[model samples]
Target: MIPNAIAVDSATGAPIVLAQAEHGAESHGAEHMASTPGEHGGAFPPFDSSTYASQLIWLAITFGALYFIVAKIALPRLANIVEGRAERIESDLAEAKRLRAESKAAEDAFLKAQADARAKASAIATEAREAVARQSDENRRRLDTEMAAKLAAAETQIAATKQAAMGNVRGIAADAAAAIVERLSGATPATAEIEQAVDATLAR
Candidate 1:
């Protein structure tokens, strides 16, 4: 609290101290009135400059302490946490790259296996087709050989039958000639003469 300026009593020519009439306590009465010349020779006690100066100094000290704590301790801790997070992110990215490479390798192996299987299947099919063709060719050749043998046997039988039939026709013609000669001469031919005439007719 501030003290007010004192007013002099002109009639008495002395300093007049205003009093709080009902309070009866000096500390309480001083708070309510101006100071007299008896209280510090009629002047204020430098207006509490020391108190203001002390308050300003303490405020500055507290601000400096708080600033130092934040700059030296709290900021470094925060930086460390940020750095750790960044390192963790880098590690995670590296792990992802490794897994991707493994996946690609597996895919390549699967593709190669599929290609090999297809090639083997194609080869098998070709071999089977070739086998079938070979069997068909062998069957055709066997049938042609059997047919040729049968045709040759049939031709030989036909030729033997034709020769036998021609021999029978010649014997019939000779018997008829002998019977005509006997009728014209009115005599029977001897055995030797008949044999010689049959031979000559056959030769002619």
Candidate 2:
């Protein structure tokens, strides 16, 4: 606030004294704000414009140290890990290829064995069939020969029996005729004459 230029009493002496006192109070407040900056708001030491060059120099040193550690140490370890993984993958692929080839060869061998077994079985079956056929034919021929011999023997026996029966019938007929002649004429006929008559009748 501005001090009153005119006093209440309208005297010049009181007005001059008031103005001097106000001036002195304002000068004292200005001195107190300049000496103790912390008492009010002010710039920190690091952010102060007078210390800018020193802050920049320290920032450059820290950045250089971090860059060197990443480039020389961390990067080499990461490269070795990548190369190890790549070599392992290549070896695994080669082993898998070799196993596949062996599996194919085994399958081929199994198929060939099956084919050979089938051919051998077929040949054995054919040979068995031919042998059976030959045995059957031999049996049939033997039976036929046995039946022919039996039939011929039976026919010869029948012919001999028939001849003997005929001879008996002729003799009986001759005796019956001789007896009939004796009964009619009251005298016996001669045996030779009776035999001749019987023979002539039997011939007709």
The lDDT for every candidate, in the order shown, is 0.69, 0.72
Off by over 4 Å in 1: 1-56, 127-204
lDDT of 1 by residue, 42-126 (tens): 3344574424665788989998999998899988998889988998999999999999999999999999999999999999999
Quick one: how many clashes does candidate 1 have?
A: 0
For all candidates, the clash counts are 0, 0
Q: Write the per-residue lDDT of candidate 2 for residues 27-70, one digit (tens) a residue.
A: 54444444332221233545555346656787779878878887
Model 1 whole-model lDDT (C-alpha atoms):
0.69
- Candidate 2: 10-residue stretch with minimal lDDT: 1-10
Residue 84 in model 1: lDDT = 86
Which one wins on lDDT?
2
Q: Candidate 1, 46: how far from true, in Å?
A: 20
RMSD of 2: 17.8
